[model samples]
Target: MKHLPTSVKCVALLAAALLPLAASQAHAATIHTQGSIQYVCSGVGQGSLQKMQAQAAKFNLGFWMVKGPQGEYLANVPVKVMQNGKTVAKFTAGGPLCYLKAPAGTYTIEGRHDGQLRTIQAQSGTTAHYLRW
Candidate 1:
């Protein structure tokens, strides 16, 4: 086989190293439309919610929402998870409840329902929030 020039070889190696990163980025979570907002939701049905609950226990962070008083599952509510004042994830409730995989730290979770805002604090072992309209 013929040897390539040093510069060409470096460029090829760089591209090879970055290919996986690019592919991963392409597959990263994406914004999805559920109801009134765009969000990256993870779980879908009852089975997914169960799986999320298990994962939440292991990952130390999870999020979900429900309607107030009657405690119905709230779907399609716009939710934003912020850590240290910077938004880490945005999701619209795909179901009456949704679970989020976030880092183990304090997060300010804001949910919008019927033009009203409901904010709450999330931390390890805290996953559920009640949102009112």
Candidate 2:
């Protein structure tokens, strides 16, 4: 029926167009595993970051990717997690933040961008770490 007002119709169309974007933004992140390590890298946004933060306590390794002269946030960075001089996990981060569930031990996190590399060390007790490049 062509009875609904123009304003109502516009609103309905807008909602329909945006529903997919909203759903994609809020999609649940997947947890990945390598050897004995379980990890996840999730994009940043109020809702998504909050979801990751809620489970932060369960992870022994955490990383925040940062870059730019003014410390702008970063995403999709290539990272590698290592322990005892062995590769533990190797993957490109899906977003600017990552969490890893690992045994209590020291770890080396390496991130590379634009031919530059940044490395950081983390222990089971450390809350989080910023890896800048």
Candidate 3:
């Protein structure tokens, strides 16, 4: 039997280590919105939001939402996730909170509730943004 070279062995090890990460990413959250107000049932819900949040943390992206003044979860708010001044995702809040999985970078998150437009910035990592309306 022939032994592999050191460089080839290192490359093979790296690929092996990264394979599971790629596979998990492929199974990561998929966001879908409907009527500009709500995420499709298949994509939005408490459970789904949790999954998205996990993915956002794993990918070093933004994830968070808007809330009411009295600490109530505000629903039906329209939200837009923007990067580089271009709208990337748009959806309506099905509950008081929503989850976003954006690329690791600066993002402008805008949402409207109770006739007011609220905007905030979301950063990468495990930080969660809770905007009050």
lDDT of 3 by residue, 1-133 (tens): 1499988898999999999989856554555543321222123453655655454433444334445556655566787777779887777755554544445678777888777888888765545676576
Q: Name model 2 segments beyond 4 Å from true.
A: 1-26
lDDT of each: 0.61, 0.86, 0.59
- How far off is residue 97 in model 2, in Å? 0.8
Clashes of 2: 0
lDDT (tens digit, per residue) of candidate 1 on 11-69: 99999999998875553334344333233444446355554444454344445566667
For all predicted structures, in order, the TM-scores are 0.56, 0.77, 0.53
lDDT of 2: 0.86
Best by lDDT: 2
lDDT of 1: 0.61
In candidate 2, list every pair of residues with a backbone clash. none
